[model samples]
Target chain A: MASKASTLETEMPTEPTKRLDTFANPNPDRDYQIHIRIPEFTCLCPKTGQPDFAEMQLVYVPDEACIELKSLKLYIWSYRNEGAFHEAVTNRILDDLVAATIPRYMEITARFNVRGGLYTTVVARHGRPPASLERSDA
Target chain B: MLDEAGRRRGILAQAWPAGQSLSPAAWLRHALQLIALIRRRRPSAEIAAIAVDGTSGTTFLCDTTSGRPLTPVMAYNDGRAGIEARALAARGLAEGPASGPYGGPAKLLWLTRHYGAPSGAGIAAQASWLSGALLGHYGLMDEHNALKLGFDGSWTQILRERPFTVRLPHVVPAGTPLGPLCRTLTRRLGLRSAPLVVAGTTDSTAAFLALGSLPVGCGVSSLGSTLVLKIESPHPISVPEFGIYSHRLPKTWLVGGASNSGAAVLAHYFDRPTLARLSATLPLPTSPRLDYYPLLAPGERFPVSDPRLAPRLSPRPADDRLFLQGLLEGLAAIEARGYALLARYGAPRLQRVVTTGGGATNGAWRAIREQALEVPISLAADRPAAFGAARLARAGWLDTR
Candidate 1:
């Protein structure tokens, strides 16, 4: 699979031209118990060979639209080996996600395992009451 | 009811059948004592016929009258009795002689031999547990639940005289009214005011109903937190080798297995909208690298069937995003292959795939699947196990409106 990808390196990949997300149903009301775990995640600046890290986990209940998996995977994979700091990466993933799927309540956590003897975990969340799902609790 | 598109769809439900392995003695143990939950709930259901079923081949030790459980019910997925199951098949005491974690009688024997069963409920059945819970009595076990536990599929022999090897549930037909809720339950749990309960079906059975009453060789691919590929067959495929289960569906069974690889992996990365845009940019299934079995993390069940199987992205990934894309594509391929194998064996060829769960709602994944499998897939109206569970509680949720 690696060789094939390399041979086709000249073939421009399907990178997005513009990042815009629209929803059919803007608000929804439902109880949700969403859980996620990322056991394998690594990031580092192209210039620095040192390993940058994030413990990425998200659990949310959905009302109208939830994050799509394939696209989500691609979006996450897009950050790998990029020149982004830990905090920026965490919020960026969350921001892009919120824009894509207008969920009722969202929680995004990035737990970067100990690197350089320093452990960093960032937690971000937004919630909405069942009755007032249109507003965000960011 | 017709939508603007003019299509037919409805909610479905069911659960595992009787003869599903829990010894009747064990079920009775809990059944006799289960009076507590009822007493606590004080269910006052108005009344109709009640349905009592089991968790696929589970029997308990119970006290007869109150249907209180004496034994701990063994789930179909529990594997403590693999040795006993194999021994039973070896002795010709079981049907088909296939030994598995889901195999019923073996687990029962293990419980019977090790613990001597629960008190009060004594030895019991899954249906008995449910019956005791709902009606305050242990009714007979239904057939599908009965069969999975090594009972002869033929309901005529009555299966009572088999041996001290295991206890059996009182097998009954669907819609058969066992009786009414106990007065104590009526007063305590408020079940007395409840409408009639039908002979409830199993979880997977309800899933089958939820999907469609897909005939012989038909099945459902439940892509939830776990990717479960269930296919119906002409012959019961009870091979423990692949995590297959003998379903209560008379001549049919629910075969195939679950893989840790599922939408859970996707959830680890994207939120939703960004996921949609990425969906718009999915590469065609032309990647030469099959290096990705695509488990976002560690371990997988179906397809390769290796628990130690680690997630591998070939040629190593240049970026997290690239690695993630490779993973998603791998999952899509695995899904297609799993369903295709089922089709090759027993299930009908992929004509229309009905998808459910939070992940299934994603158009991007759906499109990728359609292209990967070369078939049509649609999102269901409700993507919830609760919906199906309610239907099972209500018998066939579809036959009404």
Candidate 2:
């Protein structure tokens, strides 16, 4: 019992784990949307060094790998104290997701709750459109 | 017979089924059914003028000749136009509160790219399209709906600079008379009198009008999931930096701003039932000691425009009631600060506050707001969008005469 209790206490890390690791996608050949909604997203504002809150949604179609949930949560939590603007943070998240999964398609939508009176929603996407939805001219 | 004093002028409230689908035709069909049902119940009630309030920023592409929608209505919340918004912003064409992906202009641009607009097809927001259909016109749109389409009051040259080409609707003020109701619509509804179909505003604006009579100095505060503040200003105030904008009313401008803090933060901590129970017994703040910025997360816009502002919900007491009281007081303080900010920005002084939304019914919250605002606070006499639409119709008819 003493050993179990000690293991539990030590297992919980005090600092955020920024490492975003991935695993092989079970269905690599097919294109499917992976929708992730993070309602309690928080990061420091670069301008004021104040904490910015946003509700964000990350959608992507995986190619070879899929982002591990535990690591992704840790990676998002890492932004808590980091200073970044709405547009920069949104693009950075997309870049990180792409690097981790090498997704066929991805879109990150971050709606920073109203500040002053304006609600800012930043959407950044990468990769090619699926074969079915691609424009004819493109 | 009942006494003259006992008789109510309005029709008895009847619940109608609300059916909202992705398709524009579905909404139109539902609307037609609602109108027919209302007319059938009250045959003696002469229909004077009709107005519709639609979801702001919802856009659609349609053929003018056939009055048929060419594409599914892109909802106000749709984010499919994010790429287009960024591209437009890059070109400096789309900037401001109306430049986001969910905005009408971005959605219209997205529609044109995805489904090429044929010649004679027009792009319109939901309210514009509905009113146009009723009035037997295809190009009529109100300025309120046109705002998200980047139409600044009377600016057509600005829209001409966009990369894509689609016939933009003719923008008019919200209460302007479009024309008499179409012969086909009148016959379909079996109305004795053909009511004039007027240009309509967005749902929120219609809600403001529904409050009946708001003097220049009075304001209405919507305490929903978010806190929205709107005051009638003598001169139009256009401060987009703080997410504040003015909607044109006949003699006054409706200057308003929205905040991230409200009942949503309260709901995050305690359920509605628990909040109600606690609020009933909640103690008042004696000396304004436990100050909090009750936000579900960090960051707030209105009153203070700090993008990184942190939620100040610390040093919470053990008793749930006390904690709830502190949160209520904090929200009231924010409300007071928002009005003060508006005043600083040259909006008319807030003489009285008319409260609406789910949070408005709380007596405890009202007391807190009264003390914080140092102004008379009263619940809105009526808040239905329908009542506001009726008021618009009456005003439009009066204006035409």
Q: What lDDT score belongs to each candidate, Candidate 1 first?
A: 0.53, 0.75
Question: Fraction of reference contacts reproduced per prediction?
Answer: 0.00, 0.00
Counting clashing residue pairs in each candidate, in order, gives 123, 8
Query: Which candidate has the top score in lDDT?
Result: 2
TM value for model 1: 0.53
lDDT of 1 by residue, A40-111 (tens): 566774557676766688766554355556555655665565677777767656545553443445677887
Query: How much is the TM-score of the A chain of model 1?
Result: 0.69
lDDT of 1 by residue, B125-162 (tens): 46646665566556455555555655445532312333
Docking class of 2: incorrect
lDDT of 2 by residue, B319-382 (tens): 8887888899999999999898899899988766777788987878887887889865656533
DockQ of 2: 0.01
Q: Model 1 residue B301 lDDT?
A: 53
Please, what are the lDDT tens digits per residue for candidate 2 over residues A48-138?
8988899888887665467888878888898999999899888877765664555667888898988879999998888565664442210
